[model samples]
Target: MKVLDLQCAHQHVFEGWFGSEDDFHQQLERGLVSCPLCGDLRVEKKLSAPRLNLRAAREESSATRPEGVTLSNHPAQAELVELQGRMLKAMREIMTSTEDVGERFAEQARAMHHGEIERRNIRGQTSAAVALELLEEGVEVMPLPMLPAVKDTLQ
Candidate 1:
């Protein structure tokens, strides 16, 4: 298996795995390679430093992290991890500050949209039907990943 660094026209960088170099070429020629973000097909390989299979060289750089955590002492990589943590922390703060109506998300959202309830930040569960309904009603809603909550209450 080979992991090749790739980039999209939007400057979003990502890595793709292939069985061989020819496999990557074949996939690209077939127009099957796509950017995971925005699903853009107009992706082109950027000129980058050549890859070395040595473990030390790979570990020397900080960009190999599939997740935010890393076991390397690379300062560049540490900065990336720190930035990721800050972003995640900011998102958690927002989620914790918002009201959680749970399954009543759609109901509460519509109520607020129609002036039946006070407008405020809220977070909760909603079905596809509810999401579509909210969109039809011009209610601004955004789907977010499940995030960790703030430990405001003592267990």
Candidate 2:
């Protein structure tokens, strides 16, 4: 397996694994290689140093890590991760407070707006057309992104 450092036209750096240099070229020619972050298809190889994994015979105190915590060397990435955590936390709070009305979100929202049902916080799945229609009818609704993994974990 050949692991090469790849960069997209957007300047997003990532790794690409290939069977050989020829295989990498073949994939690139076919537009199969892309930036994972931005989904850009214009990717090129970047200069990379060979990786050497050496097992230490002894432990080094300087290389020790604290329990239950992992540290990132990139400051920007660390900040982004922290921001993402905060956003997810806020989203989770919103999800907990809102009732899941599923596909009836549009109907429920319209009913509430027309005083046919008591107004309450709700979250659900609805087509873009339905959401637009709800908005047109002056029924307020906020779109909530549902993460499949989080859905199973939510109480």
Best by TM-score: 2
Candidate 2 deviation (Cα RMSD): 7.8
- Deviation (Å) of 116 in candidate 1: 0.8
- The digit string of per-residue lDDT tens for model 2 on 76-112 reads 5445545554665677677789898888888888888
Report the error of model 1 at residue 94, Å: 1.0
Provide the lDDT at 66 for model 2: 49
Question: What TM-score would every model get versus the actual structure?
Answer: 0.46, 0.52
Off by over 4 Å in 2: 1-71, 152-155
Write out the backbone clash pairs for model 2.
none
